[model samples]
Each structure stands twice: as structure tokens, then as C-alpha cells.
Target: MTNSRQKIKKKQQDVVRFLEANKIEFEEVDITMSEEQRQWMYKNVPPEKKPTQGNPLPPQIFNGDRYCGDYDSFFESKESNTVFSFLGLKPRLASKAEP
Candidate 1:
């Protein structure tokens, strides 16, 4: 049977492949926080440290890009242009302006 760590690793590898095949560059962001650590931070950290509606935690800062959520969400958003930039991939520019 595969362990949780192994499962996570496989997911990461798949993400890498998807980005490569699509010619979409991306930097791997590690946001795997331990359950205990997260709980402690939530309980002990000052209110200011806690995330608010107007100010979100800056997406996990990687090489340079800001990834706001799980890999799947990141994969879907065009705003993830920053991720592609980090991977040294070119951005797909829209040819026409919206009406």
C-alpha cells in the first residue's frame, strides 16, 4: 500500500509533467503544513497575523510566483501567468480586447 507521503510525491510529479507538456512553466510551491503547526498558529498568533477578507495570505511564495491554492486551481487560472514566468515559460497573450 502506498503511504501518504508517497501519494503526495506522485501528485507533485504529475503536476510537473502536465506543465511541461503544455509548455506552461511553473515553480513548485511547498505549502504542506503540519496539522499541529497550523492549529497552533491559528490559536496563538495575533489577530493581525491571521488572514482577513481584504488581505489574503500572499500565495505561497515560490521562486517568484504566487500560488494561492492547491495545484489544481493553480493549473486552471490564466492569472497563474506568474507561475509560468517563474518556470521560464512565455505567457499567452490575448490578441483582442473585450467589448
Candidate 2:
């Protein structure tokens, strides 16, 4: 594999590992294998969310149809409930309440 491909693959793996550690389920889409998805992501996701020069490539995270930024943004959200809130989820499973 080319150097670029290896780098991208590693980034993807890092993000996936983060999700798993946080108990967040996600779907992985290898854009190189799907041009339709690539076009859709670039079109649907706002330009501001696009990667600037020298930043990481794809492997972006989305909440349903909404863009949730990249891996750095995910970790940055540690100070707030944005991550769980964006995913429409609670940080961790809560105990059952008494009737």
C-alpha cells in the first residue's frame, strides 16, 4: 500500500478504537470503495467541515445525517456533553429507576 493509504487507514482505525472504547456504535464507510458516498459526503457536509490543507484526510464522523466533525473534535468535546448529545445518547448506561 502507498504511504497515504497507510496513513488514512491508521487514522480510521484510531477513530474506530475510540468509538469502541467509548461504547459508541458506528458504521465505517471506505470512501475509496464508494464514489457515491464520497460525493454525498462532500455535497451534504458543509464546506466548513471540509479538511483544510495539511489536515487529516476523510474518516469523518456523522450523527445520522449531521456532520459531527473529526477525531480531534470528538476528543475536544470531552469538556461538554456535545458528543453524547450529538449522538442522541447518554454518556453511559444509567441504572434502572424504581417504580
Which number leads on lDDT?
A: 2
Please give the lDDT score at residue 24 for candidate 2: 80
Tens digits of per-residue lDDT for model 1 on 1-99? 998668667757766776777765465544345565344334443465446753323232233332234444445653565655543456667569879
Off by over 4 Å in 1: 29-65, 72-99
Give all TM-scores, in the order shown: 0.38, 0.69
Per-prediction count of colliding residue pairs?
0, 0
lDDT of 2 at 6: 82
Error of 2 at 44 (Å): 2.3
lDDT of each: 0.50, 0.72
Candidate 1 RMSD to the correct structure = 10.2
What is candidate 2's lDDT per residue for 1-99, written digit by digit as tens? 579778767878887886788878789887778989887777766677766754336767787788877666765664475678655666676769889
Output the number of the TM-score-best candidate: 2
